[model samples]
Target: MEFRYDKEADANYVRLRHEQYAYREEINTERRIDYAADRKPIGVELLCASEGVDLRNLPEQDAISDLLSQHHIKVLAS
Candidate 1:
């Protein structure tokens, strides 16, 4: 998995794997899930990430928590 933050976009993208994009599921205004053709989640996009990310109710929370810690990004409780 790869965690990337775009300063210009103020978004954080967690790439779960390198796969073809089948479609995306919007979780809310701040979050979206990218899935492969198999319906397996391949990535997660977090908007307005500067405000901190809420790990609650998100997929792969454990891994994302670790990533956020490594990047020093604030993690908010939803």
Candidate 2:
């Protein structure tokens, strides 16, 4: 998995797999889920990421937390 932040867009993306992109599911104004052709989740995108992200609904919370920490991103507690 990989954690990437786009400063210009204020977006944070968590890539769960390196695979072809199929489509995306918008969870809301601030969140989207990317899926592969098989409908398996391949990535997650958090918009307005500078505002912080909630990890409760995501997988690999611990690893994601570490990655976010490395990038100086905030993880909001639920």
Candidate 3:
């Protein structure tokens, strides 16, 4: 899996595989789930990053850490 933060867009995307999205489901105001043509979840997108997902913001303090531990996330350090 790959998570990328686009500084210019202030958004983050998590891609599990390079599959064409059949449709996107807005899980919430800021999160979207991307599904492949086969109806499999292939990716996720977060609209606003700097506010919603502070490295310190997850309800569980270690949530982000756990996630990063499982996959590769590219966040350019400022």
Give the candidate number with the greatest lDDT: 1
TM-score of each: 0.92, 0.83, 0.63
Top of the candidates by TM-score: 1
The whole-model C-alpha lDDT of candidate 3 against the native structure comes to 0.61
What is candidate 1's lDDT per residue for 14-64, written digit by digit as tens? Answer: 999899999999989998999999998899998998899886777788898
In model 2, where is the ten-residue run with the lowest total lDDT? 55-64
Clashing pairs in 1: none
Off by over 4 Å in 1: none
Per-residue alpha-carbon lDDT of model 2 for 1-78, expressed as tens digits? Answer: 887888899999999889899999887788788999998888988888889987766656787788888988888952
User: Which runs in model 2 stand beyond 4 Å of their true positions?
Assistant: none
Residues 15-50 of candidate 3 have per-residue lDDT tens digits of: 767888899887667667788999877776766666
10 residues in a row with least lDDT, candidate 1: 53-62
lDDT score for residue 58 of model 3: 20
Model 3 regions more than 4 Å off: 54-78
Question: lDDT for every model?
Answer: 0.89, 0.84, 0.61
Clashes of each: 0, 0, 0
